[model samples]
Target: MDNHAITTRGLTRRFGAITAVDSVDLDIPRGGVVGIVGPNGAGKSTTIRMLLGLIEPTDGAGTVFGEPITRPKRYADRVGALIENPAFLPNISARANVQSMATLRGVPSDRVDDVLEIVGLSDRADDCVSKYSLGMKQRLGIAIALLPDPELLVLDEPTNGLDPAGIVEVRQLLRRLGDEGRTVVVSSHLLSEIEAAADYLVVIRFGKILFAGPLGDLLEQERRYVDLQPEMESEIEDLASVYTNAGYDVTIEPDTVRVVIDPVESANLNRLAIENGFVLRQLIRSNENLEDVFLRMTDANTEVAA
Candidate 1:
């Protein structure tokens, strides 16, 4: 087994003259969970398809478990994937559906029961697929994928369309699967879900790599700022000038002056306000959520340092 589960360089794909996935590079390591996240149509699915050897890349190459993706047979047996949407025979029982897939793959029917428990579908395994909720159906897809006992599991937007509880259910399952030492690659647009579930994060937008690194490292890249609200609204402009004149990036607001500065420099901001004879009623440093950080990065259209 390779230390890296998948790797690509200059990977590209085009739909006629329109490039869907630009020159993208990826190095996905084995074990734990890796998240390939971006806005809708940011080439997440295309990249996965290329890796799965489902679609040919216009340029570059890659490998899975050290086997060339061009030769899927070399490694196909070890990879299980639930891509796009999972459509099961609506009329049949979940157990029957899972059992049918298991039989097709030459996997013993006993494995179906094991997988049902793994996905928390044991209780509804005998119920018709038509009676299952969206979340339950998604789990059935995962159960089918697990029947083969794949070393690498690829799930594209497994939590898409799931409700709050369903999202939580899938999130916990991903964490459990990763802890078991399997390489799980999941792609989703929901930043919160990925933030809570993924160990490594790959951010992409407009068919390009914005960032790819450990989740903590990406969070660390979010800039810190101090928000100062003067007691007198009239003094807001003057207070903002104090930082601007000193060469700090400052944004004037209706009541507060937003200063982009290291949190440790918060004391300096207070001193500056006091020196400028501006009374501050409130001064707070706000922490940004993942959505805030990601939106800012993508809006700037700049590559984030890995």
Candidate 2:
């Protein structure tokens, strides 16, 4: 068996005039939660649909468990997916709903109990789907996906429309699933949620992948800059002139001057300030968050594309 749970080479998809997924090459490994994050219409959905073999790619090829994505049946039984908001019979019990789907899939009736427990829904297993909260319903959907005890599980926008509490519930559930050694792929536009839930990340935008690697790798590569604030409110403009004279892209805030240079060079700014008779009120090195990094990357790419 291939070590990677999924791999794609030049995975491309087109919808007439628009290319929904553009030459994506992925080597997603097994046994960790991987988040595919991008803004809406960034081709996240289209990419995953190709991985699931629900839609054919326009140019490239991919595989699930080394089985060609073009032949989903080869690996479909080993995978479970919650492509979007899950649906269930509102009048039926959660157990019955799961059992019904399981029966249709030829999955054993006893698997329903096991999956419900995995999703923390055993206590409410018999509750009518109508009475379940959105979070509970989401868990029920996961239980449905778990019916086959798949080695790879894919969830699309799993926390969309959920309140904060619901988001936490799902985040914890993804962690639990990862801890059990299942390869889980979570798709979302929320970078913070992905940072919290996924060990690895594949960032996409405008139908192209921007970055793919361990989550820490991206954060570690975050651009670091110095935030300097001067003591005198009146000196802001003059202080900004100091860095501008030194060939830095300077941003002058209401009370501070920001230079787009490495934080390590902050000492030089301080020295320059003092030489120019400016009193430094505060100087701090800061790192941009992952969301900022991703946005900066995609936005830059957008400008280049245009």
lDDT of all predictions, in order shown? Answer: 0.87, 0.89
Candidate 1: tens digits of C-alpha lDDT, residues 156-225: 9999778888889888988988999888999998677788988999998877888998999888887788
Model 1: residues >4 Å from true position, as ranges? 230-245, 251-256, 270-282, 302-306
Q: What is the TM-score of each predicted model, taking all chains together? A: 0.86, 0.87
Compute the lDDT of residue 236 as modeled in candidate 2: 88
The segments of candidate 2 whose C-alpha lies over 4 angstroms from its true place after superposition are: 229-256, 273-283
Residue range with the least summed lDDT across 10 consecutive positions in model 2: 251-260
Q: Quote the positional error of residue 283 for candidate 1 in Å.
A: 2.8
